[model samples]
Target: MTVNTRELSTIESTILAYFQALNDADIESILDLYSEDPVMLPFLQPAVVGANAVRANYESTFQLIRFEVQTTIQELVEMSPEWAYVRTDTSGIFTPIRTGEGAPAAFHELFLLRKMGNEHWQIARYSFSPAGALPPI
Candidate 1:
């Protein structure tokens, strides 16, 4: 919730909220960023389809490690009025919750956000891959 809006557009702010949620390991806040039917393609994992599956994925993930990444938005394109895409590169460390082992983590992410008529934008599809080309998120 400490995200800064400043001169960012709504879409950018929404994406920043996502990163903040990840940093805080806030499951409900993360879920709120998604559309009704969200799809996630995590590294080396089967595609998570639908809201329930997405929730499960993040819940499982947050239980293992704590994210502390800084995201650099590479591109923000308005594909259409109701749809847009954001490409970001994130780099930081993830600390294992149990062992307290911190590991450097870097990835590139693509987020497809959709907004309905007079509604706020929500993520419809998301994909991220490790910069090293291995390991799972």
Candidate 2:
């Protein structure tokens, strides 16, 4: 399949929008990036599937902490006519809402995006984990 430049640009914009929503604490905007039956695999957590489950996960997270994220797109590939894969390195700081504690955070994320119709892209699957090599004991 031919990869249109405009389509590729749209995908990159969508990825940035995801991080913007997270940093803004806009759960609704974040959820809008995902498909109806999207799946999210958070680090060391059970796989969260479907919209409601995904909503709950973000809700709990937003309640606990606020995030400021910076993302660098490492790779973007068109997997099929309707699917694209994106890998990104993200670094940020999160402040606990309750304890008023702040800490730096970093992660590598993989997102599988599905082109909904012609121009719109939504994340169908996502996974993320801490960014770094395992520490030696």
Candidate 3:
């Protein structure tokens, strides 16, 4: 099957916008990237479901810290005409507002993106986990 460059570009941009919003600490922009009923599975945290809950979760984090994320799209697969999945490697530095403590963080993320109609793609599901440590074999 032939790959549609325009569709692929749109999907990639949507993923980039998500990280950009986080780095900018723009909650509204972040929320805009997600669907009405989206799910986020963050590293070491319980699953956060729904747009409102996702908003709250980001709000709480943005309150204490701001992130600067650099993402590498490892893989992107078109599941259908309207659905796609992306795997990315993300690394960033987060700085705390109150104490000024800053630390580097890295994670591997899997995102499911769905095209709402014809013009836009939004995140349907997102999950990420720490990237460094390897599990025991």
Candidate 4:
């Protein structure tokens, strides 16, 4: 789906900060961006709920490699006063902790975000996979 100019906002900037926090190994900063009761479903894991689980995931991934999330928000559809739907393509290079070798991973995700009324957005749901012909990225 394509999002016209009217649908675009500075949300992408926030998302970019989220990625920067991860790459900086700042788990706390990343957690701060999430809702207290957020839900995250990673490409390789079962659904993980709540802030604690989300933190754990970020930490675990950090242990594996430094993650750099490059996200392109493709569409933004407002759902309500506090909610919006976003589709994005995220590409990243994971630099392994031990060897510092990097592997690429790309994600195509559909996310739901709710405004917390504090100038912050919390993800409600995130689902993604590679394009049809390609294997999970």
**Which model scores highest in lDDT?**
2
lDDT of 4 by residue, 1-137 (tens): 44444434645555667667867999888787676788887666799888778888877877776767677878877766677778888787756678776677777888787777756666677667744332222
List the candidate 2 regions with Cα displacement exceeding 4 Å. Answer: 132-137
Would you list the clashing residue pairs of candidate 1? none
TM-score of each: 0.89, 0.91, 0.90, 0.77
lDDT of 3 by residue, 96-116 (tens): 777676677778999999886
Relative to the true structure, candidate 4 reaches a TM of: 0.77
RMSD of candidate 3 to true structure, Å:
4.1
* lDDT score for candidate 1 against the true structure: 0.87
Highest TM-score against the true fold, candidate? 2
Candidate 1, run of 10 with poorest lDDT: 1-10
- Candidate 4 residues lying further than 4 Å off, grouped into runs, are 1-8, 128-137
- At residue 102, give the lDDT of candidate 4: 69
Clash totals for all models, in order?
A: 0, 0, 0, 0
Candidate 2 TM-score over all chains jointly: 0.91
Error of 3 at 19 (Å): 0.9
Ranked by TM-score from best down, the candidates are 2, 3, 1, 4
| Candidate lDDT values, in order | 0.87, 0.88, 0.87, 0.71
In model 4, how large is the Cα lDDT of residue 88?
A: 86
